[model samples]
Target: MSKLDALPHGPEFRFVDELVSLEPGKQALGRYLVKGDEAFLVGHFPGNPLMPGVILIEAIAQLGGVVAQSDPEIAALKNLLLTGVRGAKILGAAVPGELLEIEATVEGRLGGMIQVSGRVSTAGRELATAKIMLSGEE
Candidate 1:
């Protein structure tokens, strides 16, 4: 099974479409296609629809969770959830038909908390960057 399957999200809420590369506890790369048919897009803008900045951050956090949960040395945490975000910058917007490339690296882990840094880009242009924290039930 794909490492992404470890995530608790269902298909509708899941953001990472494919796990391109994974380094267990170290890092991971994933992708998501921005299809115009997404329900949220209809209300995001009347005529022009852009992937929300929060969604980009969610994509990054999802990949980071995959990386953290796959670590051989660490037992899987239950209900891992994004608990915090810092230094988030929304640099660009992703439109329909864009393939977002997301990368996340595990910065550290303390108790049931994991800290990660991530970036989202498409066509060689960065869309967002952030440092996020996730916590899971011990």
Candidate 2:
């Protein structure tokens, strides 16, 4: 199975489309294409249809998970949980028909807990940023 296939999230909830690069426990880069017909977009803003900020944060967290799971030891620990989100800032809105590029870097790790900082952008412009924390089950 591909690395993404190992993640706990299913197709509908999986935000990561392609893993561009990864540095085991250090960092990861991924991308997703918004096709404008996603189920969640139907009522996100009606006419405007902006991609929600929470989804972007989730995307970042997923990318961070990709990085965290790259380590063999962490991958063995399933069901990683998101412990917290910090310093989240929404600078702009991502619309349908755009390509979302995300990157996450490991900030720290203690036992099964990992801290990561990440950002989401489209067309090279940053749309949001946050620090995501994930704890592996011991």
Steric overlap count per candidate: 0, 0
Cα lDDT tens digits, model 1, 4-99, are: 788889888888999999998999899999988888788888699988999999999999999998999999899899999999999999999999
Question: What digit string (tens of lDDT, one per residue) describes model 2 on residues 1-138?
Answer: 777887788899988899998888789889989878878898998998888899999999988887887876554456787889999999998888999999999898888889999999999899999998998876
Clashes of 2: 0
TM-score leader: 1
Where does candidate 2 clash, by residue pair?
none
Please list the residue runs of candidate 2 whose C-alpha ends up more than 4 Å from where it truly belongs after superposition: 72-75
Q: Write down the lDDT of every candidate, Cα atoms only.
A: 0.93, 0.88
lDDT score for candidate 2 against the true structure: 0.88
Ten-residue stretch with the least lDDT total in model 1: 37-46
TM-score of every candidate: 0.98, 0.94
